[model samples]
Target: MSAAFDYHLVLQSASKLDHALELVWSDGKTSTFHYLWLRDNCPTTLHPDTKERTFDLLSVSADIEPLSFSVDNDRLMIEWSEGDHHSQFSGEWLREHAYAGDLRPANKPRARSWDAQFLKDMGSASFNDLTTDDAALYSWMKQLDQDGIILVKDMPATEQALDDVAHRIDYQRQTNFGVTFEVRSEPNPINLAYTALALPLHTDLPNQETPPGYQFLHCLANDTQGGESVFADGLRVLEDMREQAPEHFELLATVAIPFRFHDETHDIQHHHPMINLDHQGNIVELKYNAHIASVFDLPEAVMHDYYLAYRDLMGRMRQAKYRMQYRLKAGEMVVFDNRRVLHGRTEFEPTGHRHLRGCYVDRTEFQSRLRVLARQHD
Candidate 1:
């Protein structure tokens, strides 16, 4: 049967439910209303409120019956009782409120994968061959998008090179912790030390209201024995969580855990979910930092469950299946999207000197450059 003839609706003229009344709309185009849905969502008594007071439709009597309805121009005038109490609704409004089309499921957008074409498009130029032009930088960024990390080999090992690389993108994010540091004196405790230490896999600046959009680190000197930076695509970790521990994934998605970073110089904290998702529940970002996570404030029962789930998720994150490990050599700079990728380092002995200068740039500017380059190529 055709959809138009599949459903039927009845409307009565009288307010009393017991009254025998004529049906106004025999054509199946009009929507059928459940008595309870109309009564609770009715326009007049339970009308959409301004900020005056909150209303709970769930607490109202579900048994309360809807008496009748009439057509007044484009509106459906509803009468709930023999008394003159009435509610008016536009047909367009009713259609919007009542219709649930198809109810069939669809697949989410698949994450982009890396391939040879992506690598070639990134421009296979050695660091000596790199230039400060739109085409070269765009190719480099496309490479980063494909591989989650890219190395610009043999860049001039100078502070000016760091500035040049950062400025290649149109927009730069000037953090209080702007690049180029040496192991001279005590910087902020939160500032990443140049000394050799195995930093945990994490997305940076979780304490900020909106963390730095992107990060660029230039390898000034990597003569130290072993200080390899490791990168893991946060999106991959989320996909694994979705498959192996759906409940834990759901818990992380729904709950907001707190993060804090404090020292003599700075104190900041905020609550954000680990797996950030879009309104449609597609995973968009990951915010994971073990050292900065504050003690969660929840009920004892919920807290216990949360700890177990958080631990399991972290264990999965640390696995080799999701990681891409590489070391930055001198004159090579790596730029990555802070919101989508987590980065860390393997410790090297502090006996030898190792130094890297870094800075931040807004992601919108980076994407804008990419589009401009793509247009030029087009």
Candidate 2:
């Protein structure tokens, strides 16, 4: 049923002004709906099956006004002066979409930043629970959204085990590296992740137009001497930068820098700001990889300042207070938002065995699954 028939909102009174409808709702909330807006949004304007708007603005007069309107059966009914058309909108729908005042939040959980201590207190879900229980899966995903990372333990010691968890959320993101990538020390590797050298704290694939979002690294084996995984919350680091060095934050968020990756077959390059902010000025993503960062081709006037800002952020991200280090054991998997979490690994003996199977799932898929889970549970 439409809100027009099922909703319980009661319109206290409705009056016709020169060009708008002034409505006083039962809860003492007042709203003004313009004449053109009301005519354009008539219930008859929408197709019954698709619910898509079929009304054309050109069909109505530019100075169109309602000849008369009334409140009946908890609905605001209006008769248009032009074409003798009529419209009836539910009080519930109008109040839900009111634009006269501050709107309610979307009800999504806000991200929480963490430090080194988070490793000890962080939550984890067993692979069995995640696969078997819908509530368990939803809770794990909720925590992932909150902290941008989580550890999944007690997984089966098999290659396909990682795929099972990834598919539960959505499809894996394919890149030049293929559907999934293997992390190990390989000879003449095209990426530094294939080497035993110490990898710096960085987000993966800043060079791509649309970089991968969440990353899942399943530790199939880890018997190396010293290959402790390191992670730093990029959101935490930048949040501090915004407060302590506002100038640096401004430059990094405004300037676009080049990132490039080249191999025998593929050469991917893109330019993006180091820090991306939403319209509300909240940090949404971070793209910082020193290895893949191309030469600074900025104007000389801003180039020196940009480097100073870059170094400041780099230094802050490397600080011990912001980073958490942990060595993964067999049958353990770590999933993190690649766009918000900076990850690295320490140097280890190449002779020893240390292998991890990994894959990527974009942010959109992760959020979509979460919303669906929420709907199911609700």
Candidate 3:
């Protein structure tokens, strides 16, 4: 049958459980909804005036039983014996929360690993109309989701342009340094980024409770030599480590290492596993910083194992097969995921001058903007 005419949505079967109900749809999809879930989500559970749930689940017995169930008028109706309450559920909601036997949400894409091959495969777009054009913004945001980084060309070198671009999807996330900051080779700098040195690939602000989601670097001038921007996919490195040494990967993922940044003015500290995982045990975030990583409080034997895993992870990060190198010119900016992609630079000689303006944006706002754009287009 043709796709449009192949529509089939009907209750094929209904079964009751001790505390739940299972329904099979005509499409051969089965969904199980708990009794408590049905009671909490019932339309009448809400206060008519306040529009908030008036039903107190705690007042209901845990052994609440459904007296009868029937599929009528394209809805599944269940009548509970207690309080004589009836619930009519739309099949659409049941399909959405279907437990595909996985603990995590099914739609979320697991992290994809990439390496030096990504250098040629990275996406790029124009900075000229990103703020004004919805299509342009959506395209760039999708690129960031797919590749974890994207380069924009021909932007105005003004700080306003940087702010405009960052604000295109979301407002700037302010830090102790400020909403935005500058990077340059200067005297008595607070961070090593202020000086000319080869910085190993690392995430930014790992010392914070929750690090900023994204980092934007806008190059205003690049008259200096040898300061090439470098990137490495931490997800790729973790995949290789898990394949070569599963035990080391487990150590990095389970051991909570403390990171700190302290000076005369500020002292920031955060403890997080270098390799973070989600409920489904998928790599979600990578936290690493060689500069500010604090001493281990772990026992001597455990510390030895952690050091081996730590040093091995760093060595793998430096492998040529997993690194991407790109040098930004004037009027160019690159935005990257600070959590998943490790970024750094090769040491540069200060022949004349080089400068870049940078800022941070939370991931929530960035993804929200893209979803809104998608809905509008749909």
Candidate 4:
């Protein structure tokens, strides 16, 4: 059989339970669709143009069940118990989205942790291809989403290059610094990034309620004596900590620390653990900025231990094994997940000129564009 015909799902049988409908596929796989779920996702429940959900769950009874259900080759027909309504779900759709056994909807790309070795085979793309081709853009986004960092080369040494690539994904995320920021030695600078000083590996704006996501830094010039860019996968370091030092990892993930960024005009403050984890204990974010990290106000009993944990993680990040040190060339732009990739710089000579322009795109926007491109490719 042809691939498309062979891949098509044909319902072998469908049995209605009290509150759910069970389906048996031709390939012997099964799926259980809850009545409420089926009702909420009915074709009629969504706007034809916008595809937004219009059905309200509260409008139906909680105990609603299917009155009758039947299989028609590749589709499942259902007569709901409420409102004399019916729902038709294609067997192909039901199978692809089956929420039974090992069948589940596809999840967003997961982080692929990396270390110094990543630099040897770093993910990179050409700027011209990304801006001109959808396939190239999708491939680049996938790599970026997986690796949390990438390099885009062949860019013009101009601010427009950075802005064009950023808008290709979505609108730029504006912070207090503005929609875009400059990175060069400046007198009376408000941020250390604007001064000629060595920066520690840290995330930007950990003080904000939601820090900027993906950061794109375009190197306009790099004629300075030093100023090599340094980056480390925060997730990689944390993963090792989880295995080698579980207690220290627990402390960092559990203890919330205060972070503040203030000037004459603005004061932004928020409390987040150095290592933020999901409910399943997966490391989702790392917020470590020694410059802006407020004084620890933990209980006197745990203060000593917290410092030890914090110091251990910071020391690991500085180690050469976890860091990728490179001198970015002009016309090269580096993109990184600001939340998961710790970035820093070596101090440069104030006499020599080094310039870089940067902007941000929220992770949501990046993921949304990726998803749309993925659908088109699929």
Candidate achieving the largest lDDT? 2
Question: For this target, which candidate reaches the highest TM-score against the unseen true structure?
Answer: 3
Which lDDT tens digits does candidate 4 get at residues 1-378? 223324755788889766788887787767788888888888789889999998888898998887888898788888878888888987766766676643554444388999998887778889999999999999989889889999999998777999999999999999999999998764345664556678889999999988999999999888877899999999999999999999999999888889999999999999878888776567888888999998778988889999999989978998999999889999899999999999999887666667889999999999999999988874
Candidate 1, residue 217: the lDDT equals 79
Clashes of each: 0, 0, 0, 0
Instruction: Point out the higher-scoring one by TM-score: 2 or 3.
Output: 3
Ranking by TM-score: 3, 4, 2, 1
Please give the lDDT score for candidate 4: 0.86
Q: Which model is ahead, 1 or 2, in terms of lDDT? A: 2
Could you give me the TM-score of model 2 versus the true structure? 0.87
Report the C-alpha displacement of residue 300, candidate 4, in angstroms. 6.2
In candidate 3 the C-alpha lDDT for residue 204 amounts to 93
TM-score of each: 0.63, 0.87, 0.90, 0.89
lDDT, candidate 3, 1-378, per-residue tens? 122212456666678866788777776666677888887888788899999988899877888878888886557888987887888877655554556321213545634568988888787888876878888888878879777888888898787989989988889999888999998764344565546678889999889988888899999988777888999988888888989999999999988889999888899998888888878777878988899898778767789999999999989998999889998898999999998999999888766467889999988898888789887663
**Model 2 per-residue lDDT tens digits across residues 1-378:** 233322544677888776788888666657788888888877788899999998898998889987788897668988878998888898777776665422222433379999888998777999999988999999999999999999999999988899999998999999999888998764344654556688899999999988899999999888878899999999999999999999999999999999999999999999989999887678889999999999879988999999999999989998999989999998999999999999999988665678899999999999999999998874
lDDT at 352, model 3: 46
**lDDT for residue 329 in candidate 3, whole number 0-100:** 94
Q: Which residue pairs in model 2 clash with each other?
A: none
Name model 1 segments beyond 4 Å from true.
1-131, 179-196, 299-301
In angstroms, how far off is 41's CA in candidate 2? Answer: 4.6
